[model samples]
Target: MRRETDRTMDFLDEYRLRPDPADPRLSVAVTGVNEAGEPVETRVTVERALTLFLNSREIVTMMTIGDHPEYLALGYLLNQNMLRPETPVTGIDYDDDLGVVVVRTEAETDFEEKLRKRTQTSGCAQGTIFGDLMDVIENARLPATPLRTSWLYALTHKINQTPSLYLESGAIHGCVLAREDRPLVYMEDVGRHNAVDKIAGYMQHHAIDPADKIFYTTGRLTSEMVIKTVRMGIPVLVSRSGFTAWGVELARKAGLTLIGRARGKRFVALAGAGRLIFDQDLAYVPDEGARHRRKGARAAEDAE
Candidate 1:
């Protein structure tokens, strides 16, 4: 996440939920030379820094594209263990001019000690840790939800087709919360962690039950991403990107169904293989269409 430090309010006012090349707010025009040495001016993704403060103390700063700052802040603190699971978040106030957000809780809390045990995670651009939450994944009892091949194919197609910063600027990642093949919420940010955090925050704020929703991301399946999804209590995690070895091991250990390299007509389920229903036959089903193949796509049978 590239934090510009000051583009929060101004850029957000012009940012649209649907991806648009014309939205100058999400991107900026820059002049550069192309591979052929020709002059080119194109839009690049915008980055901004947002500081999070829990109660009266400053927590941490996050680099983002400026959309959904409030949700990102809440999700960051919650996942960091700075905020208690049952703690009542009284209010979240964002100050655009200052590029800061303050989260108010019902209880007067302090995590001065926990804040020191930070672990730098491989969450892409943004990285931080406030406590030892590495083992929480093993404690989650995910619901035994079945994911059909039909649902998987449809979900990938729709997600790839949806307008997003990834299509608009290339240097972006997105995360979606969905039920079956239907997408319930779509979010994009400079870093994969930011996108995932935004989704988690939205779920927490809205009180959306994660018992049945599937978590999807355009980012790679890493240990950090897996842990966050599991912490949200989501059973199924899908990614269009490849998987990290540690990510796979952790998912298998936690019993979380992790699917990766998911594209048209093909997907590899590494964890929670029991939930998959092979309703679609490979003999009849067509390969992933070129148009819908997103970034980080791999050969269909390469791993699964």
Candidate 2:
């Protein structure tokens, strides 16, 4: 049998982008007290402000973990409808000292009107949507992709076991872009929206097709999450967390398959149930072990 460490290495080898939890710049060590009042040291995620600029016009400033600035800038603009998908990008300049990223396009673009309208979303670290959320996805036609139960089990197990910032620190949100049972890219941030935007930016940069991909998150399946998934053109969205009412309603309208509370062998499909294929037998599927449980899972258990 292959060693667990080797298995992890092989899984990580397939990722085009994954978290670097060991990076000193991403986190810092601090002394704290445990439940019993014993002094303990732990690493905490570091947040940096990144101001995005679309040409000479300044856009929103977001709090992030300070990785993948270019992707974040591009993704944020793309999702906000400020940057069109077909827009030619002449350059992306990121200044580390000033903490700013500028995305230059072939044509002059202005979103002063869109910037005036913003809606605060429920995502962690304060997420904002610049325009009508339904305008972009109103005519979205998601492909009828079949998601197998076997692949779902494989993905959840592998993702939970993968070493990440959430496992390293106590707080963070992760978003993964996966194909079948193999996870392709994993991005984490202070806000779930930032993580999703990072994946979007990566896809935009690589010209990757999202039709065959599955989107996974460690955050709640909220309306923002659903909108972003539909905007990315991914048919299925899954999470190890629960769902929201608007999230479920929007998923059904968009024909996007939404699955949540997906830990171990159990899951609840709130929308697009027609796309699920029950290929895996429950008898063979083991329960999610404690060792592989994420921070969200542990918090749920503690509440129960």
Candidate 3:
């Protein structure tokens, strides 16, 4: 346990970007009563509205934790099909006082019609997808990257141990962009979709190759999550939560390796099982410590 804890600390130190649970702006202290009517003081996630603009056109307003506004703006546009990968970005402007962000691109864009056709997703804080996003992944082919069980175990251990808003406050979601066992960027938000978009924007801005990366989330594997992962060209998507039927179907269709219910030594792969390599010996793996178990893991334990 001590060796694993040391390795987890080392992995966190190597992260290019990770959540700061100590940030005062991300969460606030609240006084509440427990089930036994005992007074308790705890932190709660803060949500703010961020208005996004594509050049001169106002795109949409989102409720976010407000850490990476520029990334959220760019990613939301890209995932919504308003911004293409090949499109050149001139600049991204953010006015924190006004709670607004504008993304300037070299080529002009008009999405007035696409905005009229929007699909509400099953993500927290209400996720919206514009236009026909399904068409974007019809011909998508993800790289057949192999994922080792050892790497999976290492990643889950490190991620769960790393301090974040979700661990500090109970009502937030998190997403991580990782390569093998190393987590690169860890983002947290009130909504799972926003967390994913932030990671997408980071990749686009940093020019990180997604073909060799994996995406991990602290939310259910829904269709929206599967779609966004496929659109990002990532081959592997993992979660500590369970899966939705449509999410599994989409993963199979896109050939994305979808692994969920990943707590401790246990995990379920409903799609793209061909890429998983069972290289770890189960005897050496330890069950997730009760203190470190997230809400999903706890709920699953209750059901069992």
lDDT of every model, 2 decimals: 0.79, 0.86, 0.86
TM-score of each: 0.87, 0.92, 0.92
lDDT of 1 by residue, 1-304 (tens): 1222222312233233434546677888889999999999877899888998988898878888887888898888777777766788889999988999999987866578888788888887647766776767657777888998877887777777676767766788888887787777788888999888888787787677788879999889998888888888898999988899989988888778999988766679999998899786767555776655653354434545
Off by over 4 Å in 2: 1-16, 108-110, 294-304
lDDT of 3: 0.86
**Model 1 lDDT on a 0 to 1 scale:** 0.79
Model 2 poorest ten-residue lDDT run: 1-10
lDDT of 2 by residue, 87-140 (tens): 889999999999999999877564777788888888787777787778766878
Candidate closer to the true structure by TM-score (higher is better), 1 or 2: 2
Q: Which ten residues in a row have the lowest lDDT in candidate 1?
A: 1-10
Largest TM-score belongs to which candidate? 3
Cα error of candidate 2 at position 236, Å: 0.4
Cα deviation of 106 in candidate 1 (Å)? 2.7
**Total clashes, candidate 2?**
0
Per-model clash counts, in order, read 3, 0, 0
Shift of residue 64 alpha carbon in model 3, Å:
0.8
